[model samples]
Target: MISTEYVVSEQPFTVRRTVKWGQCDPAGVVYTVVFAEYVISTAELFYGCLFGQGPQQAKDKYQFGTPTRGLTFDFRKSLRPDQQFDTEVRVGRIGTSTYQLLMHARDMEGDTVFTACLTPICIVRGQRESIPIPEYFKEKLKAHQTSDAP
Candidate 1:
């Protein structure tokens, strides 16, 4: 029911990280959970590029950061320490108070090490209030929308 193909036409966003010893297991392969962290990291970078240095700026205006409410990852391959991986993030679905990010990790050879979709919701933690996405974000997101089919 969901589209699996990556919509490359959307603005390409990327962040790179080298596999650290602490992030790997005895086998040298990166821990499974770290893959998701890469997704979250790059998504943050995406927001920073669009709006400001961090979500706090947006939160000041919109009252919430993008908090991951759902996550799904498909490990196409494994990544080992001494190797570098870059996370590619793409705008998926943008809504009034939520957005979906399509994220992937690729190795030096261009092999897809992992792929995932993360859905983040805007929520004011203490008050437990959810606010609509700000107009500024919507306008910035338009620059990253896909014009071609994935």
Candidate 2:
């Protein structure tokens, strides 16, 4: 038998952006890839709060930041550029040196327009390989998980 470890918890996150002129397709719907950027941006905000500053600012201090290892998205509905959407980010899993950030984008009517998740690896400064999550940062992330739990 194999044992598995994957924890999932949902948290609220909001995003408001008008579809750019070039972000829409012939159908005038937002491109699927656009949601991924929103998801990443929202997740970065959460990470920023976890650290002492924004994601880039935190990276400036530590000389490193979590880098996206993978991204997956499922498009459920269509969105127009005139519409703004809010996203919810959930921690789907936390591994020895990586975490999955799940995001769902919803319109004003609370309909899901898109869903995405990003797997980011924790790495050392100026290095390309993975590393164990720092003790201080792990504690901080755990606290964030606990506080957002229902």
Candidate 3:
């Protein structure tokens, strides 16, 4: 069974989002791919809030880049256009050169619409070589790490 223990974070970063017309299909339901986009954007926002800099600025100033190495999502409910939702992002796991982000999007009723896990590797921007996560960055991520128990 997939572990649900990782879903509970000590400190989660949340972003409020509204589904737009362009993100929906003819059926008025959000396109599946758009969920992935939401996760990516929320990850950027998480980093921005943690470091006080945007993705590009982080790369330019730190010479390090975080590129998604893997992503997986579970859809529970269809989302409609103009519906408001909240995406909660937490640090799932941190490794030597990679970190996993757990993201869950919930509708107004607090029901989970979808969940995603993103594995991003820290790389040297120019060389594209995996590198150890910076101490400062790792510490910041630790603050968001999920708890062991549900």
Q: Write the per-residue lDDT of candidate 2 for residues 22-111, one digit (tens) a residue.
A: 778988987777666666767776776567476777776876668889998888988775676667666666679887777777777989
Worst 10 residues of 2 by lDDT: 2-11
Model 3 weakest lDDT span, ten residues long: 1-10
C-alpha TM-scores of all predictions: 0.82, 0.78, 0.89
Candidate 3: count the clashes.
0
| Backbone clashes in model 2, listed as residue pairs | none
Model 2 alpha-carbon drift over 4 Å, by segment: 1-11, 144-150
lDDT of 2 at 134: 73
Off by over 4 Å in 1: 1-11, 147-150
* Top candidate when judged by TM-score against the true structure: 3
Candidate 1 local accuracy as lDDT?
Answer: 0.71
In model 3, state the lDDT of residue 149: 18
All candidates' lDDT scores? 0.71, 0.68, 0.83
Checking candidate 3 for backbone clashes, the offending pairs are: none
Q: Which of the predicted structures, 2 or 3, would earn the higher lDDT when compared with the native?
A: 3
Residue-level error in angstroms, candidate 2, position 150: 16
